[model samples]
Target: MRLLQKNKPVIRFLLTFFGSYLILAFLYNLYLNNASSQKYYPEFITHIVALQSQDLIEAFGYETKSIPSDYDPSMRIAVNGDYVVRIVEGCNAISVMVLFLAFILAFKKDWKSTLLYIFAGLVIIYALNILRIALLTIAIYEYPEYTDLLHTTLFPAFIYGVVFILWFIWIRNFRPKTSPKDV
Candidate 1:
C-alpha cells in the first residue's frame, strides 16, 4: 500500500500507456494482416485500378492495357489492351508510425482527457491513408516518371505532417492538468 501510494502517478501513467498501446497495436496489426492475407483488399485494389484505367483510356482514346497485378508492392504501371495506369500499396509503415505516435502522445501522460483526441487523430489518419493510396495510383498512371517522388517523399511527408500537427494541437489544448500535489 505504501509503495502503491508513493508511485501512484507513475503507475497510472504507465498502465494507461501500456493498455492503450496494446489495444491499438493489436487492432492495427490484425487489420493489416487480415486485409493483406485475404483476397478482398487485393481484389478491390485491382478492380479500382482496372476500372479507372479503362475510363481514362476510353476518355483519351488510348490503346493500352493496365490490368492490375501484385507484381510490385511499391508501385507499377502497365499496359494491357486498352488501359494504362499505375498501382501502389506502399506507405504502410508511415501510416502505422503515425497511429503509434498518436497513441503514445494521447495516452502517455493522461488517458482520460485525450481519449477523444486520439480517436479523432486515428480516424483522420485512416481516411488520409485511403486518399494517399488513391492519389498515388492516379499519379503513377498519369506520370510514371514521378512515381518515386509520390511514393517516397510527397505522400509520406504529407501524412506524417498532418499527424504531427494533430498531436501538437492535442498537447497544446487538451492535455491533462496536474495539481502541485500530483506533481
Candidate 2:
C-alpha cells in the first residue's frame, strides 16, 4: 500500500495511457473494417498516402504508378514500371498517430491547447509519413538488394525515431499542468 501510494502518479499515467490507447485502437479498427469494404485497396487514407507518395516520386523525376493489389488489401507501388513495394494499411501510420495521441492525452492539459496540439501533431506526423513512404519507395527501387535493410530495419527505425523525438519534445517542452513547475 505504501509503495502503491508512492507510485500513484506513475500508476495513474499508465492506466490513462493504456485505456486511451485501447479505446482509440478499437475505434480505428472499426473504421478500418468499414473503410476497407470499399473498392479502394488498403483503405482510404493509405490509398491517398500511396497516391501522394507517387506524386512526390514523380516530382523527383522518377516514373511512378500505384495499382490496387490483387493479392492483398494493399497498393502495389511501382517505380519506372518495376513493382517495388506494397503500401499496406499499416503503412498509413494511423496506428502510430493513435499511439501518439494516447500519450498526449495521458498528460492532459487544457482542452483548447490539447486539441490544437493534437491537430498540429497529427498533420506533422501525416505529412512526414507521406514523405517517408515516398523516399522508401525510391530507395527500394534504386537499391533492390537492400530492400530488407531499408524496409524492415532502417525506415521503421527512422519513423519511430521521429515519433520518439516528438514525444520527447512534448514531454520536455510542453508537459501538462501536473505540478506547479509544469508548463
Candidate 3:
C-alpha cells in the first residue's frame, strides 16, 4: 500500500502511456487487417510513402519505380530496373508514430501545444521515413553487400533513434513542469 501510494504518479503515467499505445496500435492493426483484403500494391499509407520515396529517388536521377508485387503483399521498389526493397506495412513507421504520440500524451501539457506537437512530430517521422527509405533503396542498389546491415540494423536504428530523441525532447522540454496540485 505504501509503495503503491508512493508510486501513484508513476503508475498513472505508465497506465496512460500503455493504454494509449495499445488503443492506437489496435486501431492501426484494425486498419491493416481491413486493408489486407484489398488488392492494392501497398496498403494506403505505405503506398503513399512508397510513391514519395519513388519521387525522391527519381529526382536524384535514378530510374526508380514503385510497383505492386504479384507474389508479395508489399510494394516492390525498383531502382535502375532492379528490385531493391519491398515497401511493407512495417516500413510505413506508423507504429513508431503511435509510440511517439503515446509518450507525448502521457506527459501531456496543454491540449493546443500537445496536439500541435503531435502533428508536427508525426510529419517529421513520416517525412524522415520516406527519406530513409529513399536513401536505403539507393544504398542497397549501390552497395548490395550491406543490405542486411543497412536494413536490419542501421535504418531501423535511425528511425527508432529519432523517436527516442523526440521522446526525450518532450520529457525535457515539453512535458508538464510540475505535478498538478489537484486532480
Task: State the lDDT of candidate 1 residue by residue for 8-32, as single tens digits.
Answer: 9778767766676677678765665
User: What tens-digit string does per-residue lDDT give for candidate 3 at 1-29?
Assistant: 97888788789899999999999999999
Which residue pairs collide in model 2, if any?
none
lDDT of prediction 3 = 0.89
Clashes of each: 5, 0, 0
lDDT of 1: 0.57
C-alpha RMSD values across all candidates: 6.1, 2.1, 2.2
If both were scored by lDDT, which would come out higher, candidate 1 or candidate 2?
2
TM-score of each: 0.56, 0.92, 0.93
Give the clash total for candidate 2: 0
Checking candidate 3 for backbone clashes, the offending pairs are none
Candidates ranked by lDDT, best first? 3, 2, 1
- Considering lDDT, which of the candidate structures 1 and 3 is the better prediction for this target? 3
Q: Judging by lDDT, tell me the better candidate of 2 and 3.
A: 3
